[model samples]
Target: MYRCDCKSNVLSVLLYVSECWKFTANIEKRLEVFQTKCLRRIMRIFWPNMISNEELRRRAGVSTISEIIATRRWQWLGHVCRMPIDSIPRVALRWTPQGKRNRGRPKETWRRTVDRDLKTRGLTLQTAPTIAADRAKWRSLAVASSTRRRRED
Candidate 1:
């Protein structure tokens, strides 16, 4: 019997998801369709025994890729929040450069996604860092946020 570490599995899944996102970035399609396609491909790689979508869903019993990404974004947020103010991640989170409006609409950023996730959990930018300082508490919040998002979908 072979056992895979949960952290390694998650990291692998995240890497796969980012790759999928890169491929699908320019293609305009409904979110459901995009997610379904990505999920199918990811499931194929991760769980070969679960040949059907229904079986994959049943056997995996895990959050969707989007939810996992959201969870990870929050986890990163927590880590960045605990870092020094001058740190790169923290600076990136706080800084906005002077730029021309070269687009009709701005693309969604990781920070924006984190903000949305925080809002859904009744948290705010100012308070998130403090809340996330507690490791166990932050993990619970991230997991809960992912599960809640999954249920809504």
Candidate 2:
């Protein structure tokens, strides 16, 4: 019942080592048949370093990335792989980055959300006046009142 500091179970850790060994054996056997000995062993053995064991599971046996999506575990695996940065689904992870906010803080536009139903009635901008217009009206009223005060004095 010893938990390795690497957070790997003893039995499963051994199984993972065995899987890596089997992978190397399979790769070597296939490559030997082709007579290509100059293949970089390190890259194939550990391709583009994954951050977690869950990600290792996803990469090792999951054939189609779409299979990962269908199971709805892609997001879990994505976080395990430190892949939350990419908005694209792993099935189509290479698509054009659309609506991605990169630089600076996100735009905090004051969208005028309404509680009224819009299905039957239409979108009508009835009396939502601009703040500047209201300010101007108040300023004109204040000026007129001050002028009246001076005349009364």
Indicate which candidate wins on lDDT.
Answer: 1
Model 1 scores what on Cα lDDT? 0.61
lDDT of 1 by residue, 24-108 (tens): 3333234434544455555544444436544544444544445555565666678888998899878887777698657775666
- Total backbone clashes of candidate 1, pairs 3 or more residues apart or in separate chains: 0
| Clashing pairs for predicted structure model 1, backbone only | none
lDDT agreement with native, every candidate: 0.61, 0.29
Best by TM-score: 1
TM per prediction: 0.65, 0.14
lDDT of 1 at 43: 52
Instruction: Give the clashing residue pairs of candidate 2, or none.
Output: none
Superposed Cα deviation of residue 133, candidate 2 (Å): 6.9
